[model samples]
Target: MNSHKNASLTPRGREHLVKNIASQGARKAADAAGISTRTAARWKRRYQLEGVAGLRDRSSRPHRSPTRIGSDKTERIEGLRRNQRLGYAQIAERVGVSKSTVGRVCVKAGLAKLPPVQDSVPVRRYEKERPGELLHMDMKKLGCFDQPGHRVTGDRTRNTPRAGWQALHVAIDDHSRVGFSQVLRDETSHSACDFLIAALRYYRKLGVPIQAVMTDNGSAYKSRRFAKLLRRLGIKHKRTRPYTPRTNGKAERFIQTLLREWAYAYRYPSSDVRAAELQPWMQHYNFSRPHSAVSHKPPAFRLGFDGNNVLRNYT
Candidate 1:
């Protein structure tokens, strides 16, 4: 008998059923009472057939929501990153979006972070217009493996003592790229003054008045003797900023060139042999080597140094 008996309604379910019952078949009344005619019909149909079970919502939501961020938002995120290359925080700040939004958008856009490049240049170029106007000078000390009975072949060293020599002082014309160098026993003011005198002589040979000479802030260069030498020659002397090698770009670059091509090119058993080796290499570099910066022409050609005695054309 209990199974056969139909039960009364739940407070909520009963409210729903009672509303449908009150509306009956009137569409306007059903709508005004927060019940759809279809729902009322469904309840009646179910009462005639199954019962209260069909009164419940089938699945709460309709099929679709048009409010989601679409393909357009993804494209926008990619466009922002491509144009500005901003990170999530920066992109959020600039575009007036949340960092999480930016991140999600970027993820949808298939964006990736770019790695940085290497910067290993020994020389940093400063602007200089004319040849012989600003000359840069520096000294490079290469090991001279002239230690008795020790075989030395370019940077290969024994744990024994070393007899090294200074690649005297080299001076390069900022515009012409013309260079002057001599192998010296040490880096001293006297050595620098000697190099300066030779440089002046070389420029004088070219009939060009050198405006100034720039060099590193080495003690040998900053000494009073070097100052007096410059005063005597009536040539201006300029020192680079403290600890700044790039301030004298040409000199530093030439030093790099010398190391790559000549200093490490071969091995010498003694200091004298190393120094002797340098002259031929310098001759080749000055006369035969085609400089890349100056239209791939040799410095001698670019600077108007007509060496009738030059042995080769490094075209």
Candidate 2:
């Protein structure tokens, strides 16, 4: 049992009180211990009968609870929760019990929440051996705002008109998680091709030559222009299966980090200011920030560069 902060006695303190009682009578011990004489006498008797073990706190649960729900009803409640995935109200209605009673039964049986549905295909995680062997590419659409949105000002009426949208194109090495991103006007095939070229050039500077690129089956990726650019660069293009975003999970994961760290990280005065911040943030992400995928080392470390060297070259 956990003692409250204001509790006067613990198991050890109780033992000390028992010792005091043996020396000076129970009345005097009770006065010194700041407990009633009855309580002191009870502890003394318990210590004498069971020694140190009796001084420890015991469960306050009663030995018998006549009003407790029966075993049959509890089994029925657990069965309904497990088989039918029923809520407390539904289970109570079907089992002819109060909703609170059903909740208590469910909590006792460890069925307070339902388990996640198991997928038929077991998740198979794989990573490329080299940084450039496979690169994951994806895009996220962000609202271009002139001022802080309702999230900051808490004024829903102060909305910007024709704020438009910016497409955030992201590319990341499957192995190192070294990422590059650009905020473009649209997510068209032409914009995707341009971002790919810029990302390729950036990776080349890091000494990582691109071999293959994996992207979601979007219209931009399916366009002939995007395909032609990849063909011209002699890089293989891999498209994720339709409706399965996890196939391009690295890029998706990178976008989530980017959103949290850079995109919505601060309240920018305007879209241009947020766009200007992207380059410096990307530099930090690639060279300074520790990546969990790369064993808590910066993504640059996976590219065979030490801290001092990376700072000198990239900074």
Candidate 3:
């Protein structure tokens, strides 16, 4: 992706522009989309030749460079720094190179600091083999809005009245990373139970029967009513160890992604308008957005579907 300074359009926003140009003329579409006519024509030609993928931002880095230090010299520099604990000047002196070259190489190799070696132990992460084997649940409290917040407007002096908070309850499948989210007034036990029921129904409609759920030891998840609901549905309920959220990491990570991509993706005049956009954003997340953890495929692909259509006999 292009840096923010150089980027002219987002992928989705570019798609919207090209779609409009299909019906309207290029100049008019460019005017409507607030983009240059040259850009519109170029992207239109790319769209015709390479489709949507062509409109995506390509890497700006050159394919090759003559000034970069050779691998053997970089290795010698690293060896001197690691064994002798020498500064860039000393290392460069020994390696017959300039200090700036040594510094750049050290920065690229993550040896620019004099800190001690960190423990090399790798963190163990596990995922379920099948969808619905384990579901992670969590709630995120978002600030409510009476009007556009300071993030939308440059002035922070305006007194925005408090209207309360919106609790976003989310459930995600541990295996596929598919998520279900809803905005609620509170995170009480009753609300949690209702959200669970609705989430289970939504997953069931997608052909996955949930077997177990994992949550933090929150008051709502620990309530008798929630336990009773789980028992009635024959779904095992598990809680993470106190103060160790990694056990429920899936839901935690989903909440982070939700906040970055959807909740703050665009400015809204009110929370109600933001809430209204959640369902469509959720649909796009499930069916279109590529996930890094799942080999860059959308969550729906792992959930035994191609987009919204079910692919039968998929395990």
Candidate 4:
């Protein structure tokens, strides 16, 4: 009979309504439930002044369901949604109904839209406690720059002097979210190892020795030379499962960041041109950019750990 606004009522509202109902039906039971004196008096006043409807929240909706859908039709919409992940348009098409009907049905079913899926336990596995303790590595490829009057430049991957997409090899500290990266022509194993060498040197400049290195199951990381290099450096080597990028999520996130911020930020002329721009961009990212994961602190803050301490963050 009444319209619907926010169907969801709070416990306080429910208690007030329950008390009002009991006062009319069973006053003795309402008093026994320890209904506060102030709340009871207010309920009594609302009932007397505005009657039963005054004690309830007013609905802003229209008085009648003008587009009242049949029970069978609403049930049909929900069935399509649960059986198949059909979108509103698709469901409407299948059910031979209007798009709004499917939307309204979904809302009534309490399955309007799926919430964003974020794992409570962050899949970015911890390798070590400190910044230098463990580092995760990954690679991403971007297109080249776009140049005028050049069809090749029209494509994001075209090679150019100032613009082009290049492979980004990133290394990140698991605990501190400190990141290091290198841009190169290809994602070859040699390139990965070279990036690692440079990353090691970069940390060494800060007096931090990498205790361990972690990477995905890539041929570059699986090379004999890479293994020997790790042994020579006296650092343990760990590889995450194949295709499980989240196991090494820090590096993956760095790649996602690169996509969101630099490569996808603005359009360049060509791949060669875009590739060339990477060095300066990396310099700014590593030294200047403040990371939210590290409390708005730069990665440099986690550098220069004492040899006695192996890890910087643990959890």
Candidate 5:
């Protein structure tokens, strides 16, 4: 039994009250202890019969409960949950018990939720041996907003019909997990080519020479301009299999993180305000945040940058 802050009697206080009862009368002891006379008398009788053990707290559970479900019913509920995957209401209807009872039984048996089915095919995971061996590129589309959307303001009445759409082009190094991203006006072939050039330039400044690039078979990526740009730079281009986005999983995962940690992560007054925060966020991601794939070290560490050089250049 947990004693409340204003509880008149704890186990120790009960013992003290019992001693006071022995010296004074029950009424006087109850008055001194600030408890009812009947309560004091009951404790005095328990102390007389069972000593200090009686003064200690006891379980509040009743000695027997006729209304509780039996072990057989509990077993039936759990078996239904595990074997038939029946919900609480279904099990209750079958077992002639309340839904809450079935729920309780399921919780106690650790069958509250069904386990996720395992995939038949084992995941084929791979990594590059060196920085710039392969770069993953992808684009994520985001809606433009003039003010906080319904998600932030909770007012669906204010809608911007011609708010337009922006494409977020992202490129991440397969080996280092170093990411470069930009929000552009559209997802056209020209914009894709320009973003790729900017990304390649950024990697070149970091001394990571690009060898190949991987992207999904989107219209912009399949454009002649994008292919010619790669050929001119002497960088090979690899496209994911038809309808297989996971083949270019690194860029896909990077876009997911970008959305969760940056794009919708905050409620900005306008798209421009959100765009302005991306550069600083990217700097933090590249230099400060630890990458689990690279042994919990920052992405810059994989590029072989010493502590001083990283702080001096990237910081």
Candidate 6:
């Protein structure tokens, strides 16, 4: 089955050549095969030593490679990648190999890429069993600009003067991953309470009643007004551990996703323009965008609700 581009004699042809040489001599066999006398002799010698095996096209690769990186070095490179989660350049520097070689080694070792680094210990991930069981509440602060900032416009100098700061109040259901957000004036207790009320109404419209709420130990959330509002609503209010934001990881991660997909997703003429887009973005996020943690289905789908309902209202 082996093929050669320039070879005049295949394995069968070489066998014929050897037989011809045995009967008619090397000169006639070489002439018949259209090969040199030296080639005919070489084929005859190969047939004598290896029978048909040697004539069946041997491998052209050298048995040994002097310049190839050693297995020990490749192991070291992969070790750095798997154990330390080093990038290609870092692994290469540590293992004394080229960055490309380190990348290849990592790929071959099945350790080429890793997940993003975590800020805390490997705590178990848990989701509320029911959509209305718990809700995560948090506030994200974004810098207000007169015009699109560097992240949107690409050129840092193209932006107008800084307008001020904007507080983004975000609420997400733990089980369904449904979210609601608003651009607020400040992070005061009154603003937080107002956002919470609006968020509750939004979820209520979707038929998911709120039973419990979790927030970071921010001063605003700890205020008596905020506590009173929660108490009156008969909703259990839990604060995350001091200095441990991951206890409210759902809202934290949601805000990060919002910043990536909405806040910086487009170039806005002004802060007002960006703020206006939040409602539409939230609709898409809840009804259309796939949530990776939830089996790549939208939030509404996870809650056994038709996303088209939200889309219908949007239209």
Best by TM-score: 2
Q: State how far residue 96 of model 5 sits from its true place (Å).
A: 0.9
- For all predicted structures, in order, the TM-scores are 0.56, 0.78, 0.61, 0.58, 0.70, 0.70
Which digits, one per residue and each the tens of the lDDT, describe model 4 over residues 123-164? 443446666778888888764544532442465453446554
lDDT of 5: 0.90
State residue 237's C-alpha deviation in candidate 2, in Å: 1.1
Model 4 per-residue lDDT at 17:
55
Clashes of each: 1, 0, 0, 34, 0, 0
Q: Write the per-residue lDDT of candidate 6 for residues 1-315, one digit (tens) a residue.
A: 568698787888888889899999999989988989998999899889999898888778999988789878877886778778879988777777788888777778778767567664888789988998999999988888876677855687775564778999999999999999999999999999999999999998888999999999999999999999999999999889999888899999999999989888787788888999999999889888999977898888876766666554455
The C-alpha RMSD of each candidate to the native structure, in angstroms, is 18.3, 4.3, 19.6, 11.9, 5.0, 5.9
Residue-level error in angstroms, candidate 6, position 111: 11
Q: Alpha-carbon error at 95 in model 6, in Å?
A: 14
C-alpha lDDT of all candidate models, in order: 0.70, 0.90, 0.88, 0.70, 0.90, 0.88
**Higher-TM-score candidate of 2 and 3:** 2
Q: Tens digit of lDDT per residue, candidate 1, span 1-315? A: 122144333335544664656656447545645667675565666655655555443555768876545666657677878776778888777666688888877776667663344556555456577777788899987555544333332344553464444555688888878777878767888888887887788766655579898988898889999999788878788888898777887789898887777666565455677567776787677666788877787677755655564433322
* lDDT at residue 41 of model 2 (Cα atoms): 86
- Candidate 4 deviant stretches above 4 angstroms: 1-105, 114-127, 143-166, 264-277, 304-315
Name the runs in model 2 displaced over 4 angstroms.
1-65, 117-123, 310-312
Mark the 10 consecutive residues where model 1 has the least summed lDDT. 1-10
Error of 2 at 301 (Å): 1.1
